[model samples]
Target: MTRRPRVLPLEAPLHEAARIMRDEGIGDVLVTLGGRLCGLVTDRDIVIRGVAERRDAAHTTLGEVCSAALVTVGPDDDLGTAARLMRDQAVRRLPVVDAERRPVGIVSIGDLARVDGLGPGVLAGICQAPPNV
Candidate 1:
């Protein structure tokens, strides 16, 4: 797993985060503090909360819309488990954290796809064979 994902501080204005996301071609940012994972922000947050509320993105801090209920996984977690979490939660991104909840990296559907050689209807990695007795 790649370490130190591009992060945005919760104190940063929502607009700044949006700019970074667009510039980086990523849809989400890990909200971090002192190198620890705290929360997360996404483009959906920008549109659903910031624009819908008519809040000034330039002045609105990520703390306003960052989902503090962060669902995370460890770097050692298998990609399948992460996929299950995404499907169960209907979330597109997940913060890869250590046992102490410190941010190690970030994972997204894009990342997972990259892992499995995504192409022509490929889903994810086939890590194990079917059980046979």
Candidate 2:
């Protein structure tokens, strides 16, 4: 899991999110409201929901496009649980949160692939699974 996952306020602009992703070399950001995790905005969301829609990046807020139906895990959760959640949710990433729903870290498919025994096969299953549509 990537500790200290990047975060931004719900009111932050799309351009700001893009800049943070570019500067941090990350693909997504946890969106917060009153210091609690409320949503997630990925690079793909920025393109498909913001840019592709022809919205003004500087004016459009993350809350407007972020995926608000969050599926998260706690820091103590095991990799197997994380993998199952990701597969079931059709998500590539899961925010690791504290008791207060504050993000503490992030687990990604790449992170799972690094595990000794749970490697490519798990990833392949996730990748090969049909879309949640």
Candidate 3:
């Protein structure tokens, strides 16, 4: 899991979120509302929901573009469980949280492959996939 995952306030502009992703070399950012996890915004979300949809990104907030239905994993979760969750949810990344649901880190399929030896094909597919829809 990647500790200290990037987070953005719900009101943050899409342009700023995109900037963060570019600078951080990440595909997504966790969206927070009042210091609580609320949603996730990805590069694909920016394009499909922001640009292609013709929304003014400078004025649009992360909350408007982010996905609220989150599929997270606990820090103690086994790799198999985590993998299953990813497959079931069709998500490439999973936020690792504490009991309080505070995000402590993030795990991507690539990370799983590196650490747990998930299949290379799975890792490649996830790495090649467009950011979370």
Candidate 4:
């Protein structure tokens, strides 16, 4: 899990968020509203919802593209729980949150692939797939 998650306000520009993801070498970032975790946005979201839609990145807001129906896990939740949530939601990532629903960290399918004994073959398949844009 990445403890220091990249966070941005809901009104942040889509292009700026994409640049931050590229610079941080991360596929997703936490989106906040009034200093609370409100949602999350991924590279795939940017490509499909922003670029592919031809929405001006500089004008588009994270609130317009982020996954607002969040699938999150508490900080103390077990890895199995996290995996189950991911599978049930068909999402690749989950934001670890605190009691107040504040994002504490971020976890991805890749983070569990090896430790969960889902071999490299499976991991590679997931990582190598192109964005569904």
Candidate 5:
């Protein structure tokens, strides 16, 4: 898991999130409200939801485009549980939170890939294409 994951307030603008992602070399930022995890905004969310939708990045807030229905894992959860959550949710990353639901870290598919035996199978499941809408 990546400790000290980047975070931003829900009211932060999309451009600010994009700048942080670029400067920090990260793909996503955890969105918070009242210091609690609320959503996630990925680079893809910026381009697809913000740019493609013609929303002004400077005016659009993270909460406007972030994935709010989160699927998080607790710090005490096992790697298998994390992997299973990612596979089932089709998400590339999961925020690792504590008892109060404050984000402690993030677990990604790449992090699972480094494990001895869990990588390939979980990755395969995550990579399977979604059916046409």
Candidate 6:
């Protein structure tokens, strides 16, 4: 529920964005401008939109396929409320946003699974946190 998240700038190359995602071991990246959430890009977008479409990662910008239709929620919103919104909307990720539309941490189905009040092992496969914690 932090109010500041790691973000990729609009001009970053698609490949670089994907690299960062992989390096961070996260599935999505929040795009920002002037410190506010502007878009969201996921692994699926890269493979489907970028690769399937034959986009040149070297030349393609994150802004090209980044979904400006960011489904976001306030930090104060409960985990259950956030999970329901994601499920009902058929989205895998949500960008936590502030009143000014600034991105906070992201919550994916994985993160939600952790908060679903399930027992420990219930999330071992879902959240994909670093191993051997």
Pick the TM-score winner.
Answer: 2
> What lDDT tens digits, residue by residue, belong to model 1 across residues 83-115?
899889987888899887788887777667667
Instruction: Give lDDT: candidate 2, residue 23.
Output: 78
What is the lDDT for 30 in model 4? 95
What lDDT does the true structure give each of the candidates?
0.79, 0.91, 0.86, 0.88, 0.90, 0.80
lDDT of 6 by residue, 1-133 (tens): 4335568888889998888777866667888878788998888989988999999999998899889986789888988888788989998888998899878687777766665455656564646557332
Residue lDDT tens for model 2, 11-127: 999999999888767789999999999999999999999999999999999999999998999999999999999999999999999999999999988787766485467665765
Better of 3 and 5 by TM-score: 5
Model 3 TM-score (2 dp) = 0.85
Estimate candidate 3's alpha-carbon lDDT, on a 0 to 1 scale. Answer: 0.86
Which number leads on lDDT? 2
Clashes of each: 0, 0, 0, 0, 0, 0
- Lowest lDDT sum, 10 consecutive residues, model 5, at 124-133
What lDDT tens digits, residue by residue, belong to model 3 across residues 4-122?
99988999999999999988678889888777778889999999999999999899999899999999989899888888999999999898878877777888887777664455666
Give each model a TM-score: 0.79, 0.87, 0.85, 0.86, 0.87, 0.85
Best-first order by TM-score: 2, 5, 4, 3, 6, 1
TM-score of 5: 0.87
Model 1 / residue 26 / CA error / Å:
0.9
Give the alpha carbon lDDT tens digit for every residue of 2-117 in model 4: 69799999999999889988886778989998778999999999999998999999999999999899989998999999989999999889999898878899888877774656
Model 1: colliding residue pairs:
none
How much is 105 displaced in model 6, in angstroms?
0.9
Better of 2 and 5 by lDDT: 2
Candidate 4 Cα RMSD after full superposition onto the native fold (Å): 3.3
